[model samples]
Target: MSHLVRSGAWVAGALVAGVSLAACAADSAPRPIDESSPAPDASEVDYRDGEYAATGWYGSLPSHQDVALTIEDDIVTEVTITTPAEDPTSLQHQQAFADALPGEIVGQQIDVIALDRLAGASGCSEGFMNALAEIKTRARA
Candidate 1:
């Protein structure tokens, strides 16, 4: 009876080993690459492609700038900032920031766009970034 049980156990072990070998052979077989799925770079971006606009206000005096941006392929293709500067000094700073804006952001990825002390306008940079956050929200995919 003991011999019979031992032989049965050996047979079960043999069956398990056979199954494992079959599985290993299946794993080693070449599988065709799935080309149906889009490549990571070609996949849809989280932010939708389109023109977006937002108004951001900053400073103790609370100046405002209207930010408009065009996004294609998750990158900023164009940008415009309309500063309703109430004073000449503020207008000069805003204009400086606006002039520097296109070069800095036009070719940048939208998700990573931010500025600090651009064109010597620290306050304008702050307002621009604040507006960009809103633009990102509007452009969310």
Candidate 2:
């Protein structure tokens, strides 16, 4: 009937408008930290020495990542990142990230390490940051 068609069109229009608003909001969201800039020193912050681990989720496909950090005298001594990526491409990307992470973070003070992206692993970086925040909380003396 004419009424049914009119209601359907109204519903479709509402759906389109909702999707458009969501897209705009996503576009205006804050961007990740820039890797090129120098990170501020965290040497002054006191940290309890121990191994800390945290899990984080990232990407549209929602990959889960775990990061473990070993701290000694408030400095990071070792770093381990694990990503259980079933897809071959995802595995490769995660492996590259893992390979590059140690050199980027090891021997640095925990507070100064700002890891957002490395070795083309942007999505995993978000999860890494989240895990790092947890580690920081545990590290507080």
Candidate 3:
């Protein structure tokens, strides 16, 4: 019985250590928002006049969201969000997006737009950022 107990303790310790290491590695990974990395620009659009989908996460949380972005002449004209948000009460994101989206994409390149600004969005902002990232990655592909 003592041997079994010791084995179980060792297993649990190993599992805990493994999880901690994984978490630390993820936290240390390079982020997409690093200022040193070149920003994605709209001019990189080789294909235009189509709708694309993007998916993103809120930091490292399990929460995720999706966005459908329309590109015209390398500019994001329309963004149709497929997933709403984690919370129902916060609808500020939709309104803020309605007000700022057009101006945000005007002269800027499609790839350049980062979720950095939207992180401030009230409820669904993080999800929106993740979705936007996914969309841009897809567009570039």
Best by TM-score: 2
lDDT of every predicted structure (CA atoms): 0.68, 0.67, 0.47
How does candidate 2 score on lDDT? 0.67
The residue ranges of model 3 lying beyond 4 angstroms of the native Cα positions read: 1-45, 59-61, 86-103, 122-126
Compare the candidates by lDDT and give the number of the best one: 1
Better of 1 and 3 by lDDT: 1
Residue-level lDDT of model 2, residues 4-99, one tens digit each, is 111011121110111111122357768798889857556657899977767666676767566777789988887766657888888887777878
Model 3, residue 75: C-alpha shift (Å): 1.1
Candidate 1 root-mean-square deviation in Å: 29.7
Error of 2 at 21 (Å): 19
Off by over 4 Å in 1: 1-45
Assess every candidate by TM-score: 0.67, 0.68, 0.48
TM-score of 2: 0.68
Give the TM-score comparing model 1 with the true structure, all chains together. Answer: 0.67
Q: Please give the lDDT score at residue 72 for candidate 1.
A: 87
lDDT of 1: 0.68
Clashes of 3: 7
Error of 2 at 54 (Å): 0.8
